[model samples]
Target: MPAGPLRGTIRVPGDKSISHRAVMLGALAIGETRVTGLLEGEDVMATAAAMRQMGAGAAKHADGWRIHGVGVGGLLQPAMALEMGNSGTSTRLLMGLLASHAITAAFTGDASLSRRPMGRVIEPLSRIGASFTPSPGGTLPLMMTGAPVPVPIEYRLPVASAQVKSAVLLAGLNTAGITTVIEPVATRDHSERMLRGFGAELEVEELDGERIIRVRGEADLTPQTIEVPGDPSSAAFFIVAATLIEGSDLTIENVGLNPTRAGLIDVLRQMGASIEELNAREVGGEPVADLRVRHAALSCIAVDPALAPSMIDEFPVLFVAAALAQGRTVTRGLDELRVKESDRLAVMAAALTAAGARVEETADGLIIDGTGGEPLRGTANARVKTHLDHRIAMSLAIAGLASQAGVEIDDTRPIDTSFPGFIPLIEGLRHSS
Candidate 1:
């Protein structure tokens, strides 16, 4: 932990979720799409590379990224396998983008992504006439054959997953009729928002508390200028860092405050954190704000199940916060954490326990008994296994800030997939103080 309070106004990289969509949708549109504040991380860069391989002119410019697209249904067969490079978002969503294009494409990823299940996206896409030959256990390194004249169908999401939902919706873009997805639980709406922004005819209806999203097929998308907001997920580590470190005061600027993705803020506030949303505004169809977070004494609270979809990616760091707060923090309805880049639920529990915090791992979530604001007894010799998950690597690094002996991480390479500048940013903040 630093000897003094951290004080600074910093902006993280652009929103990863939105940046992925921007690149994918930009590649599918009929004309040029200009994206400002695009995240140049490895994951998003993978999407750009795939787009270029399939006939899109995705190139960098002085301002941002400029993408000249191959219209819907116009994708060319790639010469080699599309290397996804640890991005599950890129793999799943790209599978959907190619699902109706009458092309044969093979997708592959690094070890972490190769271990994740692709069946969620594969099953729904197959229902819409796409054929796939995935690895055993339905993992990646899969070959896909798209249906030239595809038929659209209504899909009801069994789980709340934005990537799965986006895959189905993107597959429907070039089909023959209207394709509808009924989400039993809401996930991030970045795909839907970006789809509509690109001139695709899409409709959203909420009935009986379920969202029914419909998109017309054979639709042509018009390109536009987009400015992506800062990622809330990347900001989570800083928010927890400032909250736990005594006397710290920091401001995170231009963070995407999309209600669907801002659940971490709500949960932290519920735990007695001092977070103020300043300069509330909208950018590129999403809510944006500057968050002023100050160190405060926090108490534990039961996190609601419904909040899972919104804060799913933030849970790892939230677990760290729980380990430092007073009393116990209980979380449930997070089985989805088990399927991320690593088994986040189990890995987080194990890592926190090694740091001298009491954590009980459940089937769905974790039960953490906090140390009541005391410094964690982690040692420099105690290394946390990140399993190549970006969130896990970054979350544990933030934990090291307040640990007694400073935590050691097994690998930080995974951080390049999302927040490439995370370590530098943290070092700058500490050095400034």
Candidate 2:
């Protein structure tokens, strides 16, 4: 099979992290929030329904989406269990939400999500008068009781997880006093920034190499319009495609360049990718920019562990870029990747080796030996197993566009979790090629 090239401009979906926060914050606010460019993926949609079940109103607008908040500390009891669908974000954040409210609710999800650890959020939220009924090793499908009158807490994170931090901060929104989180590792601050953007009094301090976060409780949020930028994670596939595929020049517009999530750009640059940032500016208290990428000779470097929290979602595609580079790419600080939608590090190693890249697995990461800028040639029918992981599916699909025999992923349905327009985007690039 002859390998094809990627071309054309494709606007990816809004950032999944941002989309989740918008719905949640809007649900807690006192008025309506108009959200433009909302990512309508399953995870986000589940959050929308969860908000409605909790007595918050989310409606469709002509140009964007809208949410009317139920007021701070104003959540009503949900009639049924709030099904989070395939979203780890929803389940985690809701843990914080339920921890502060005076209600009892059960959370559930699909098979893949059911197995993920909820202990991270459960442990911290439990510190502030919230209780749980029998979760097996902190897994999902557990009944959680909210403290109708929550006690504000000064919690500390064991790891740098934005979800964990955000969960605590949101729960604090309704407590009697300030809620705080101390972190040795700094994850994305979108929640902190957006909380301030919506008129919440939040503070951040650094001490002893730890970030101390505090949020004022029992607040009222002012409704504001939100324009979500295209997701940088979604753009990772195309960025890797442009780097590995020759004669490729592509520009992705209006991508969120939040410092916390721009590690892939830095890693690609370190690997000698011909990437440029244009139209850098601030929108809605967060940065926005356009990314221009073209083919470049890449040499692998050791990816440091400290950078894992920032680009955690992009590692699968980054592995694809490593497979196309000339040298070995060794990554550290990615034990978290093992417990994502799939064991992504192992999944990438096995899938890339099957496509003719030399890859080795370690305790935390992978080492890939590239073909000296040579394209991979494999059997015509080698199928990359996605393990029902969306990122893995999208990464393998992008690899198929650059491989020698042209790859086919075992499942493409999972791509809708973040990039619902993936097939059409790929098809568009194929047409231009």
Candidate 3:
């Protein structure tokens, strides 16, 4: 499908995770928080719109995005339902932020997001004194009434989820005392670090092989200028494309390399891919570097389950790399994938199989047999069902690039949710290279 090698220097969108947190935290600060390099994706725009609806001042300027805050516990009741579009992060985090305030709001999303569970956040927020009336099966299209006098308590995560951890921490922000979260497995620490940056009293300690995070509630926040970095998650498609396509030598610039989120790079390196880190630096409290990737012969290996937290969102694309590798790639301990935007495990397995690769779906993970680096002759007239999941659409597009015939997706509209202009970027690289 690809005309030739994809060789170029490019930068993906700003970190989606960081961009979401910045707007939320900035809206709770005392003054204007200016953010440069904010992602202008539909998902993030939904968060910003929700913030604006709740009395935060959000507007785009010639320089960047400027958000005027109303301080902690200052959110106003929205006049309409908060449309979340497709962002689980925005919904869960906002539920926590609203849990300790005295306002009531309704949360709704598109069909894909409506199927994902919100009970993970609801259980903790309910304990913090908020009340929720979720749809059948604890999904969205729900009403949440904030606790006028919220209670602070210690919560232990029943599962490994950064969203769950962040929800509890955010609810603790407007509470009256110290609230704590005990994480059996560490997820991303963006919330913890960003909380401290915005002047919340927070502490982290490791005891008995678990992480304990505590935050003082009802704290005042200070606004600051934030320089967001390129997203590594958005960078994955091109990274894998460059690695799988012959003669590809691509340099992706300013990708966030947070240690907690770099497991994909590690796994690819273990599978014998050529990725070199250049210009290592730190921006906005996160490590970042340029990645120079070249096409190389890949081999299969069993992925470490513990690394799942770091690379959870990446497994879909990783499945593509594995399908064309030299042996069977065994991935396990991915039970969490079942609860994402779609059942990523099942969707990716089916998509790869339809594209002429050998992929077996397992209960918790996927078992994929590689083509030993041979380009797949894609199945004729069989299109990939993306299920409105953006990663699936993009990952399969990359598969088409490395195949004799192009992969066809049911829809590419979902690609704009996170990585807008994705097709243009790929086309630019294809023609210029």
List, residue by residue over 1-433, the lDDT tens digit for candidate 3.
5548989899999999999999999999999999999999999999999999999998999999999999998889999999999998899999999999999999999999999999999999999999999999999999999998999989999999999999999999999999999999989888998899899999999999999999999899999789888988999988899999989999999999987788899999999999999999988788989999999999999999999999999999999999999999999999999988889999999888888899999899999999998887775687779999998899888888878887889999999999999999999999998
Each candidate structure's TM-score, on Cα atoms with residue i matched to residue i, is: 0.99, 0.98, 0.99
lDDT of 1 by residue, 1-433 (tens): 4335779999999999999999888988989999999999999999999999999989999988999988988889999999998999999999998998889999999988999999999999998888999999999889999987788989999989999999999999999889999999999999999899998999999999999999998989998899999999999999999999998999999999999999999999999999999999988899999999999988999999999999999999999999999999999999999999999999998888888889999999999999999988884676789888899999888888878877899999889999988999999998898
Model 1, position 309, has a per-residue lDDT of 97
> How badly does each model clash, as a count of residue pairs?
1, 1, 0
lDDT of 3 at 370: 99
Taking all chains together, the TM-score of candidate 3 against the true structure is 0.99
Query: Over the stretch 1-433, how does candidate 2's per-residue lDDT look in tens digits?
Result: 4345566666889988999999989888888899998999999999999999989999777989999998887788889988987799999998898798888899988888988888888887888889997467788788999886788989888877999999999999889889999989999988998899888999999999999999999888988799998988998888998888888888899999999999999999999998898889988988998888888999989998899999999999998888888888899878899889888988888888888888899998998888777888753776778898999988887777777787777888888877787888878887788
Candidate 1, pairs of clashing residues: 1-401
Q: Which segments of model 3 are wrong by more than 4 Å?
A: 1-3
RMSD values, in order shown: 0.9, 1.2, 0.9
Go through the candidates in order and give each one's C-alpha lDDT.
Answer: 0.92, 0.87, 0.93
Model 2 misplaced regions, further than 4 Å: 1-3
- Residue 371 in model 1: lDDT: 90
